[model samples]
Target: MAKKPKTAITPVRSDNYPEWYQQVIKAADLAENSSVRGCMVIKPWGYGIWENIRTHFDAIIKKRGVQNAYFPLLIPKSYLEKEAEHVDGFAKECAVVTHHRLEDDGAGGLKPAGELAEPFVIRPTSETIIGESFSNWVQSYRDLPLKINQWANVMRWEMRPRLFLRTSEFLWQEGHTVHATAECAATEASEMLEIYANFAENMLALPVIMGEKTPDERFPGAKHTYTIEAMMQDGKALQAGTSHDLGQNFAIASDIKFSNQDGHVVHAHTTSWGISTRLIGGIIMAHGDDDGMIVPPKVAAQQVVIIPAVHDEADREAIMEKCLGLKLVLETISFDNIMISAVIDDRDEVTSTKSWNWIKKGIPVRVEIGKREIEGNQVFFKRRDESPREKHIMPEDEFLGSIADILLSIQNNLLERAKSYRAQKMKKIDSLDEIFNYFKSEDAGFANIPHSLWDEGLSEKMKTDFSVSPRCLPIIDGELSDRLIIARSY
Candidate 1:
């Protein structure tokens, strides 16, 4: 049997990975299962992290000439059928709306009423409906290279939902762009993939492998699909984000045609890219430890949490006053272009309770101001990146002065740590026997397998034999190589 843990969370990562993940989310109070099956309700703390992610990525895309817009939630059934491949891809997972209203059934329970002439689909993705808009909006060559993005929720009926990773309903930002030429569309897709990689590495402090998906795994109707895949603590791979170069497939299907400078009409080349709330799961699995999550400093909802240590009633006011003052000062500071956000814990709980709460929630820095520290004009601080038992005492002003640099250090350190972890788990396999032997351990991570040895049924065989999948084929030295990364995935 696995040993019990000291903290509120139990069944450590090595003991039970799936349960450990759910426990981490529970201890952090990030999100919870909703009344509806395959759905989740994101709590304030979890939403705050998502908000940070949206804000940063929004700024980045806007700088690249992408405009944010809203798309319809319900799409006509015929619209999806315009693209044969797209419809086939999402047909089984779509939620169809057969009736528009509900009425009281004769037997007491309410029942669907008023069958519509044509069915509507709760959008599993906005591609089809958004394509209709693009068809209507683009009429001339001047409208070429139109870039649009939408932040919305989508529903894809999942049989086995797992919180943020594969919920039926989840929030995401999808970028759709049109170009005059196929080359431009391909470039746009590649650029968006790079943007996602930067966000994963710099903001989330989660290292990822970015590459092109194989034909069997490419997005429906896409010429090529680029993805950023991150390795989890359990040695499984998670597809963090995807960008698809759709060529002219979607444009032609939706009739998005435009007049060219040469006095000819042609279908526009298009691209679509997205990153979803699944990234929250990626963050949890990438940096979380036995103690709990270690939120990257760059995107932490609360960078610094001040817990006053007041044993005597008289000392409460002074310590709290100091904490409030520190909060105000910390708010005014900036690090790596991110303004520091801090909070004072004035709750009626013990200092240990407050500290552990924030620790599980993954606050980057924790400070405790006590009678002795306040009197001595010093601050006791601990970094989430270090051991929970380790603490440092520094003059109050010095601590405040170095806070920004300290946070930057923590962010870099987390990325470095993840990089090292991935490096240790990565191996190069030249033979099929070696690949089979490597994955036999069950914790087998990533293997760089040569495509020359790939057979007609290798992918299916791998899945059946070891539950592993080919992650991606990376481009090296400006050439697409036969080498691919194969691993088990979530």
Candidate 2:
């Protein structure tokens, strides 16, 4: 029998995908479980990716007339109680603060001491608290379209935590907007869903299916919820982002009333949309190989890493100089309107080790300069999107001029590869029996069925039998389609 090739990540994805995922994160030094259960400490590399995501997405929303704002972290318990459905939806996950301070116990440990008149809930989702502020901020039609976004951390007591995928605490950006009419609010929700889909595809190189959630899957207290779902390499769906059309539900709950042009006081229509750290996990699962992550160039923390291969002491200085010069030149070049970022791996380690380090970190480009390459005036490089063994050598001038194009190529390739994979895995099913049969396999992918066929009984049967649920009613072209996608998801 032919032997399996050795991979950097043991229990290669084909053998054990979940374990391989955890190993890839460890190898890349992205994040680690914290002492606090169900939480993570994102290392520099992981947080850097998030920063890039935030910076790019922030600019996109700002261009749409959305303003950045801050809201209180501790929300009054009464605020959640105001929206019964919303509170009930998140009741099990809410973490409440009942005491004001802690006092010393006889056992020499801290214990709850000063009780408060009213308890507070750590911000699970900012809808209620932000609605309270919106109620006071909007009093007339002039303040109809109040768009605001906040970058914050939220706590939801996850029963099963897995790093970025699901944790007790995670970082996210939540956007809330108030509009005069329900139609306008609905438009806002759909627009945000498109923005999320575009960002996932173009920036993160994650191809996603845009769709509307079924009634049972809609966000708590939302009139309608839209989502952008991406198919991971393992054929499971990941709901990357969501937008909710509140349709005056939150406004009525919080009393966000405003005087309309007709001189009548009425509750405002509202919308809420958000994306979170879970996206990092999606990227890893979608683009990562048996080796490690393959971050798209547009959102890569470092787009390029220049490694100096020094075999002898005499040639070290010249190679070092060339690597530094290349780093500076690469940084000056721009891709996707953002300046390229490059770093030199000059640590006292073997060249192969340094190269593999950057490869595991999923940097798009790795440029290596040794004594021979310096003398020949050439740059040898490898692309993360391609096999690690594949290398290309080009003249120094040619490499400098084409670095941006190379990065763009990597980004496009990753996106196309994922799109192709998902297309191959997706199947159109005619009956519930076929759906069950499809998922009986190990990696069943997405099953598309007519929306008319979906009913509460089928939903329950699918869930109970195969752990599958309706993903969405996919949006095709410019409109929502009758086709529904069902799958096991993260």
TM-scores for all predictions = 0.98, 0.98
- The local distance difference test score of model 2 is 0.93
User: Which one is best on lDDT?
Assistant: 2
List model 1 lDDT by residue over 329-425, tens digit each.
9999999999999988889899998999988988899999999888899999999999888999999899999999999999999999999989989
Q: On a 0 to 100 scale, what is the lDDT of residue 439 in model 2? A: 92
The whole-model C-alpha lDDT of candidate 1 against the native structure comes to: 0.91
Clashes of 2: 0
- Least well predicted 10-residue stretch by lDDT in candidate 2: 2-11
Task: Estimate the Cα RMSD of every predicted model relative to the unseen true structure.
Answer: 1.8, 1.9
- lDDT for position 221 in model 2: 96
How far does residue 40 in candidate 2 sit from its true spot (Å)? 0.3
